[model samples]
Target: MSPPPAESGYSLVWSDDFSGAAGSLPNQSKWNIVSSGPNSGNQEVQHYTQSNSNSSLSGSGMLHITPQHNNGQWTSARLECKSSFQCPAGHRLLLQAELRSGTFPANQQSGIWPAFWALGNDIRNGNNVSWPQCGEWDIFENAHGADFSLGTLHYGRGGTDHLSKGSARQTFQVESFHTWAVKVNRSPSNWQDETLEWWLDGNKFFQVKGSDVGDGELWGRVAHKGFFPILNVAVGSNFPGGGQPDDKTTTGLGSGLQVKYVAAYKSN
Candidate 1:
């Protein structure tokens, strides 16, 4: 619970330990789920299901994606990483994950967005190279019941050439299980240095140095190789605001997005 970051050298290898067997799915050697119906910014609609209400694994360790309500609309959970453990490029990656449930339904709010990401496996489909230059790494995201959460970085021409730095909503305190992280550094003095950092349960709530990424004609010199890792839960456009589902008190905000394990490290 905040002891896993070995100073700043990283070395966890890879982890999922959601135990095993529960509802099956995520363990195809490592994980490689995509089943279609994902892309979000193209326009949300909700359609990534492995069943067991989207995802499951609870022999005791945890790992659940439960967001039920299909046919009438609402099916989530999208996993990633296509081979054993990708993201080799120039090396420098550390992605962690942990989440808790309960909150969402304020007019449905678009459709309950929840995520932890990393992309760029060539971007697929003939590889024409589209979407932030086939590179994106949103450490974590929670749009709707917004109490604060985001860590973005999308490259040239994919979302208006994005770049982000975040930490708001007072920082953290949305009902436990917080250890979302990301730290990727390429190096070479500058080429933007390639940076991003976010942590709440272990402090350090924000950072995005590296001179602010792209639009200046391909940030960080491309050649990022081909990233990986991603977990999802979506439905809605602007946010949970477009799906409609608000008003179900507990402490305030309400919806779904419950996960309890996801890890990757390799910074040396």
Candidate 2:
């Protein structure tokens, strides 16, 4: 297990320990289960489900987001934080989670894509925002059982034309528990002067400044305000080879993402 991150000069603002009874659902007041299967603009094969079978709490203080294959179809869960939990500018926002993948057959974890990410809250507040223009922060993403995770930021003029800068593959075992995190320090008066950093197991691996992001106008309007957290395990998306799951190779059992806990903090 990775050591907990240093807490110097920071105070915890919110957190989910997932300490409910086994088979129970996530805390409704904090998270909303996304129940749509819309292409997700990624041509993913999984149908996001709100049922406890896909997203549930284990008696042992953890959240299990399992993906199952039924009758040649896939079902998973995507949980988004409530609007009230947005992280605003001027304050340092930090999100940390202990994550690990479930067991899998030998070399059969090819299509599994589990991600812990954040989307700008402006898009959801009826601000007439769109992808890329709204900005996206990928805290951690593991594609096709790859031994390394990718931390990236997507923002630009529009959906068709966007820019991205990512970390250089931080390696880790998929089945082993590891701490993943992203921290953003924003200027109170000027959001463009903000700095973003990514960490794996308490070590900083990537970072970028708001000024480095594409356009100043778009960055301030879309990214400066704040963002909402999202957790999901997608099966067979464009990032993982853009192919459907092979029934012969994919096993539903032990093919999920496990979260020990998730928390947010404000830096002093």
Candidate 3:
């Protein structure tokens, strides 16, 4: 994927254009298709699977993570990057994706959660660790098919005491492609003053500085460590207040999350 428009100084460090044959899974070397080991904590209702029915390539340059209802149960897919990524001390690291949600109204989309986010690389198998402690950056998050999207930072500790802040919700047209991105700019001489910016369709809507987090260690969890990208579409989860899909909820491809591309860049 090319760097965001006019960002000519950025060099592509990694990217996935989703150009595989129709119905194939994403490149295994670059991503892990999570089939299990989740849901217990999130209270999510959908069972994540590696089935093509849930995730596949469109052959026309797109990755589709479809959420479907079957036999009174729901299922979906999630893909996590295999490599840890971070911006260097004097540069910027940019993460961006072209994505669109399924067509449906807010009421019908209740309990549907689609996201493009990241977590610290420290979170791995057999490590037995909690989230946010490693830190998180939510580049794109939408719930209940809301007209707005949120960009949030999760730092400090985890659970009840976890520190969190979301950008002022920015309204957008859903069901159509939009570019969601986050730039971790390490331009400041002091790490505490560096900034994390959130952008949509080339327009920056919100930002937060390390000073805003107010803790060097906590800030370092996100700024100084490595993180990987995640793409998933969930249903009936904790984030949506435990709401479940009703008969009105659309299933199958109509409710899938379409991803045209995802890329990472480093500013030169």
- Compare candidates 2 and 3 on lDDT and give the better one: 3
- Model 2, residue pairs in steric clash: none
Per lDDT, what order, best first?
Answer: 3, 2, 1
Instruction: List the candidate 2 regions with Cα displacement exceeding 4 Å.
Output: 1-6, 38-40, 84-90, 187-193, 221-223, 240-242
lDDT scores of the candidates, listed in order: 0.59, 0.77, 0.84
Given candidate 1, what's the lDDT at residue 198?
A: 61
Which 10 successive residues of model 1 have the least lDDT summed? 244-253
**Which regions of candidate 1 deviate over 4 angstroms?**
1-14, 21-62, 68-91, 96-110, 117-137, 140-183, 189-192, 196-209, 213-241, 245-261
Candidate 2 lDDT at 184 equals 76
User: What TM value does model 2 have?
Assistant: 0.89
lDDT against true structure, model 3: 0.84
All-Cα superposition RMSD per candidate: 16.6, 2.8, 2.2
Per-model TM values vs. the true structure: 0.31, 0.89, 0.93
Candidate that beats the other on TM-score, 2 or 3, i.e. the better one: 3
How far off is residue 217 in model 1, in Å? Answer: 25
**Poorest 10 consecutive residues of model 2 by lDDT?**
240-249
lDDT of 3 by residue, 1-268 (tens): 3223435789888888888899999888998999973475666788899899889988888999989888988899999999878988988999899999777777777678889999888777446557868889999988777778889998867667688878887888886799999999998999788999999998999998988998888887788778899999988766634466778878876666888888889899
Which should have the higher lDDT, number 1 or number 3? Answer: 3
